[model samples]
Target: MDNTKIAVIGAGKIGGAIAIALKNNNLKVKATCRTEKRLKELKSLGLD
Candidate 1:
């Protein structure tokens, strides 16, 4: 089966939850957040 790539905007609670759920299902999750700080934080958490 082909892997699915999902993009979740915003790193807030809802967005984070969706990304986590999709990842748990073996799908690729990409999260976009406003501000470089938030993006850096997400990257540090290995959620690039």
Candidate 2:
């Protein structure tokens, strides 16, 4: 991952997709969502 840090604020549909894309590229990803449910969903997708 080259020690790179990426953060996605308000990770909804589009933002979540972007996060996933970056993660699939093996980049460091940090995503934030408004609700716990959404956060759990993102976590389930393997996003941090």
Candidate 3:
């Protein structure tokens, strides 16, 4: 567990959920989505 950094590609529903769950566990989580709308949603979920 040296690097806890996580990147969620194609962050739709499942991706977003996984990212948020990881984030909740105090891991560094980043997510990418196809649309700006979903991107903002991911950001609102406290993901980078």
Candidate 4:
């Protein structure tokens, strides 16, 4: 596999869910949210 990294901008409900789905499938994901709290949540979701 190429293992290309994914960048999911705007980590809202849909975006976050997509990021999570990618992560669940063992893909590398990077998501950006509007707030620090949301960003932290994404980190907790296993994102960097």
For residues 1-48, could you state the per-residue lDDT of candidate 3 as single tens digits?
Answer: 546899989889988888888888889988889999998888887889
- lDDT assessment of candidate 4: 0.90
lDDT pick, better of 2 and 4 = 2
Model 4: per-residue Cα lDDT over 8-34, one tens digit each: 999899999999999888889999999
- Top-TM-score structure, candidate number: 2
Regions of model 1 farther than 4 Å from truth? 35-41
**Per-model TM-score on C-alpha atoms:** 0.67, 0.92, 0.88, 0.89
Candidates by lDDT, descending order: 2, 4, 3, 1
Candidate numbers, best TM-score first, in rank order: 2, 4, 3, 1
> How much is the lDDT of residue 30 in candidate 2?
99
Backbone clashes in model 2, listed as residue pairs: none
Off by over 4 Å in 2: none
Tens-place lDDT per residue, model 1, 1-48, is 357788998977688777777777778789988788877776766677
For candidate 3, list the clashing residue pairs, or say none.
none
Clashing pairs in 1: none
Winner of 2 and 3 under lDDT: 2
The residue ranges of model 4 lying beyond 4 angstroms of the native Cα positions read none
By lDDT, who's the top model here? 2
